[model samples]
Target chain A: MRIFDPHIHMTSRTTDDYEAMHAAGVRAVVEPAFWLGQPRTSPETFYDYFDSLLGWEPYRAAQFGIQHFCTIALNPKEANDPRCLPVLDELPRYLAKDRVVAVGEIGYDSMTKEEDEVLARQLQLAVEHGLPALVHTPHRDKAAGTRRTLDVVRESGIAPELVVLDHLNELTVGMVLDSGCWAGFSVYPKTKMSEDRMVRILREHGLDRVMVNSAADWGSSDPLKTRKTGLAMLADGFTADDVDRVLWRNPVAFYDQSGRLDLDDTDGEPKPDDTSSFEGNSIRRGGE
Target chain B: MPNSGTAPHPSLPLTPEARAWLDTALTEIATAPTTIRTLFPAVRRHCGRAPLPDGRTVDEAVRALLLAALPLRDQALTDEVGALHRYGDPAEQRAVLRALPRLDPEGTGRFLDLVRQTLRGNDNTLIEAALGPYAAAHLPADEYRQAVLKCVFCEIPLARVAGLDDRADAELARMLGDFASERTAAGRPVPEDIAPFLHPFTTSGTTTSGTTIHGTE
Candidate 1:
């Protein structure tokens, strides 16, 4: 039951979450740059946070036996913040780094005019960097927001295959699939798609480019949903092969389009012993 | 065998010969994870204590091979190194420490603590390896200052201390002044390497005598 969650916020989660993730057979994750809970006062804050996504977070994840990759972006929620607008200008430096897999979490939040402009620009950044884009549909008025989000993505001039529309639901998945871009369903607890609902979607949609993630983060979410979805797929009469295609292969095929999803699990280095540190700074804290 | 002159930069581009050794090692390590231990005698034959595992030295080959662990998917490399550090003999312990330059970005505090521990012992070979570029680049300031004094206490030449010249500070000068006093009190000659760093903090003695507190004009 190896899993590659294409959308998760590991920076916001704890090391214990990483342990639980590994215990549930999650091998690797893509932590997309999203809005922090608090408003950032300056772009320097984003720079430091981005550096952690690139450096410290990866180091921390490795200690837990998970290979961590990230998506760099100006998240749609913060797009409305004029103070954070400069982060879009500084996006290129972070995008050039080795671990970045996409220009992402980039799409409509409140579906504002400011959100629209930010989406178009970051999509262009995706094309310029030759990386994929991960689009986040607004939870409020999602049906409408997802529709407007698709229009902006269409106009970005980046190939449709190079984008992944995330936080998708039953109403929006069909249109996103029709657009030829990847569709991501977050099998979260309470609000988003649950495991049973996700299994039904896999049965109906037939698993070509569909992927499932926990999208776990600072919000009320579950990191184990990817695995729970896999279990549901099995209970719903999907074969092991079907589960593999959905949980692992689907995300790989999508992110592999970037030509940078170098997951070392199959590439065959020994597992990392992240229990070490640089100077005195360490990801290897005592206990679980 | 430590390259006391100039520690090899961790990112030193591998040459053709070194590349070949690493290739052979990576392939072999895939099957035998502990082949790193089997490599030391070969290094002794080709290059005694040289950190660059290259050409015919089995040690470098082993080192180059173990580096493959650095990129592993899980905690295997950390566990493997941890296992070696826990059970390995002094030479094996030194080999793991020596490999830190190439294998860094490693997150365990144990490795740094191990390097600090080596400085307190009488083994110059281990101390020299521990003092290489990784220590220079990563050892925290307080630990690094104490590490220098450890070298002086052990009579290990400060020449082998990587980053000694670059990271030296006034605090280190003061610490060295106290170390010099400790040596003089014990009637052991203070190694002259103390002179370069000691001069900054030492002041003249009172009474207008021709003598100075640091014992220099």
Candidate 2:
């Protein structure tokens, strides 16, 4: 009954959500860095977001016995802005850190030349680092973005298997799977893809290396969309194993390849060691 | 003074006025029903109207009443108004505290103490302390770098700060512009050393080695 959500923004969620997810058997999650509803102006702002993903979030998740991981990438929507580069320069240090499983959620939005250039550079970076890349296909003219994304990955000479094309609808699914890449479906509320549609896709596609996510962020999205989708799959007569593969196994297999996924459980509370006297000061006195 | 290793636990309970204020609000909301009806609006609202869990005692109703009212006073309500937000119902909140059992027990010992420490404070120190070390040990290095950058730009202390406020947004935008200018002059990348912290929407180029990529279907 365990689950692994490949995409979720835990920072936007509450502790109750952690507890609920744990109760529902979500053992781990991968939170990709994304644009907050508002734009970030400086590299420092991006820095703080990354810190929370790695810092406060994991700690919070641990309290509920869930493992937290993240993907680091510059989003394509903001790539056209020349101001976003300083933050981009600071990415390598984070990539080297343990627990960064993928470089993703990157791809075109408006299909502008700037987005194309940014995608190319990021693809090259992924190749240089030998990391897998997560591609976010544009909402408008998705077929074009998906095609262009596949072409760019091929043109860059990076292995097709190293790319994850996200937010696929019926129109672009064939091209993505045909391109020999992983296809991700974000089960959203009244927007991207519905749970029923997701189930239909799973039924037709047979769940071979395919995955589904809530992709819940700071928007009108459902955090329990994955669970709902799982329920739909069950109702649609999909076996528990099929449900498990899409919900848990595939994500774990994909992330484990990065060697960053860890799922050790710990006693949730802090138990800092006490010192009577050390370093020329008595640490215990501060509490008094 | 207590020993440095053991601070004296505060023994004060809720003040009569404070308890009375809370009780009064709870009663008003409970009687009117619709007034605080939006608080939890879903399960909690109905629970408030249903007979107590014990079937006869008013305490269950009272507890539900309090659960619905306390969050409003604290200004921490979310989602459905009548229901508790992501923190959980009052009983669940108590259960979480009991299970984890903060070492600094006196932190929430009194109503005024809780208010000063959590509700009225500049930050939630307890949650921050709880998260600090674990996050330091587990979060990937890139994410950590981004957090440091956020702390510097927003001028907030690392401990207990959630994020930049709207007021800081404009300043962050201007600072980013300046940062881009500096990078262009240096003929370097935009994020330079901080590239790993950028989100998928913000950065250009692929990730470093050892990461996996998944496509959307």
In lDDT terms, which candidate is top? Answer: 1
**Fnat: each model in turn:** 0.00, 0.00
Runs in model 2 deviating more than 4 A are A265-288, B1-217
Tens digit of per-residue lDDT, candidate 1, span B1-217: 2122232333434555654555555555555666744443233322233344342233433444455444343356667666555434344555678776556554334356667666655444456668876777667777778888877665557887887776676778888988889869989677788799876544533122111112112
Cα miss at A203, model 2 (Å)? Answer: 1.5
Given the true complex, what DockQ would model 1 score? 0.04
Candidate 1 residue lDDT tens string, A59-78: 66766678888998988888
lDDT of 2 by residue, A1-288 (tens): 667998898888876676677766677889988778898777677776776676556645654567788888788877767788676676765565455778877899898898888788878777766677888888898888789889988998877777788899988887888888888989999899999999888777768668788888878887788888888989999989888888988988877777556555423432221110111111111210
Question: How displaced is residue A57 in candidate 2, in Å?
Answer: 1.1
- Alpha-carbon TM-score of each model against the true structure: 0.62, 0.54
Q: Candidate 1: which stretches are off by over 4 Å?
A: A266-270, A273-282, A285-288, B1-143, B146-217
Docking class of 2: incorrect
